[model samples]
Target: MSVKNLLHSSKHSSKHSSKHSSKHSEDILVGVGLRHPHFTDILTSAKEIDFVEVHSENFFGQGGAALSVLQQVRETYPVSLHSTSMGLGSFADIPAHYLARLKRLTQTIDPFLMSEHACFTWGHLQGQLMHSGDLLPIAHTHNNLKRMCEQVDRVQTYLGRELIIENVSAYVQFDESYLSEAEFLTALCQQTGAKILLDINNIAVNSLNFEGGDIEKSVVDYINVLPIDSVAQIHLAGCSDVPHGQLVVDDHACPVSDDVWQGYRQALTRFGAVPTLVEWDSDLPAWSTLIGEAQKARDIANAVLGVNARASVMEINHE
Candidate 1:
């Protein structure tokens, strides 16, 4: 069998399929990010996905259609909360109101897991709210890691659940760094007891943009460095081709590339099957199309894990 065919077959094969079957099908849930454009379509389809994930900052409002739809969706499928604006690794203090809102949503939605980027999304040097509009990187120095650990502790404490930290797509390299991104994230999970929400696309983006190294090798290296068990879930997103450059930008504007699908399958091989998400943030597709794309993630997870078409753990356990 071809490598790609082997990956697909091993993922969705039966009990007699492969040697690795320790992780259950329930652990291989599929989900998509909640965006304004896809809200109605997601709400419309009742049998579409295993769960849904939303950006914490987007639902920071008191009352709106977004919250209402979220409330309705939670009744049907599990929801995973992902935040881009928390800035947990930043030097700035945590936003009081944002935390409260996130806390409230967690209570209301009862999400299975909540995650945020390892990079700080907020920055205020001297009292002004200087929004970076991007997931800003933190100094990897020991002192910086200490500061970041405290912030992560605070967020998990407030939320009363383990917060999974995702590695961001970094565009620039740092000079005063102490640990590699892998080491720093592994340490964060070790010290703070928070799990990791590994984004395969971000690793690829960072690898191309900054490292200028082999993408597949980079993925394997990062996975090898991380504690395999802490990989609670995985994220796959589309990226854009950089202007006049070979590296692709981590823009969630395109479809999941074949490179990323290969990475996902590799992740399943290394980490075993976990809840994987398809994140398409911009130029949203139709609801059915988005769900179809999400199914691709599910298919990859199922194929790698050696489950059947039903792919439902509840069904697997019953048998």
Candidate 2:
């Protein structure tokens, strides 16, 4: 996941791909999270989608209808395994049993990408280890960074593939930590050869919870700070603005806010059309509605790419 390797991949994938950058940008994959209700709809619908993502824990069974559904879906499109419980930041290493199950699922589905959160979930309770069942934040310090790097390395070695880590929305920030989240993520990628799953909605939620300024700018600045080569995927989801803006929740139920969309455009400008996913989990939408969100992401990316392509052509002609 070094800059050199990413650059070579970009060049190799795009060579003879298209004269227009927009066409190359079409290579940028857009997908929706596969939920239970939409199983038949996703396979039957004629909607345009590049891939479908599933939470890895959902299909760890030896044999079941869930795995069968996934297999049927995989036959039609690529799959991505998004694990919610592989808390890489936990005090202990990733649980071997969990990793074994995930490895089997990955072997079965052959997902296009594998991802988990950058937060910790396991903690000691009265001298006994317990699962928190939620993503918990870790302080951004040198020691934590070293631990994360080691954990990431072990996971990669066991999985025999690179694992992409995602930033989670948080309710609290550590006071003693000096390193910015971006700096920590940068070093993690540089050291462990892993990539990032940039969640645009989480950025906005954090901005509202912590900064309370113009969230769109906050998102743009956050994306700008990350090394471009480190980002491998983008997640577009919605926040719950029920009670007030400050107390909003990262519930992936509503439509993506205008602010997040603006940030997404900025992200594409910086990251060059990375794989983007539109996720709606809680108040699940009809397949048509959910697919509409995915289409919007695809459209925004193509628009940005079209502008870049034309700008590039003009620059070349000027030269």
* Alpha-carbon TM-score of each model against the true structure: 0.86, 0.89
Q: What is the lDDT for 147 in model 1?
A: 83
On the 0 to 100 scale, the lDDT of residue 22 in model 2 is 36
Which 10 consecutive residues of model 1 have the lowest summed lDDT?
A: 1-10
Candidate 1's error at 285, in angstroms?
1.3
Q: Which pairs of residues have clashing backbones in candidate 1?
A: 10-303, 11-302, 11-303, 11-304, 11-306, 12-303, 87-121
Model 1, 1-319: lDDT tens digits are: 0111111121122221232235654457787887888777766767768778898778778889888988988788778889888888888787798789888887777777688988876776587866678888877778877888899887776666777789888767689996988899888888887778889899889888776657887887787788767787789998877775666668798888787888887777666767778898888777777788888887777676765423433332232
Cα lDDT tens digits for candidate 2, 273-316: 68889989899988999889988998888887774754643443
The TM-score of predicted model 2 comes to: 0.89
| Candidate 2 global CA lDDT score | 0.80
Off by over 4 Å in 1: 1-22, 25-27, 244-247, 307-319
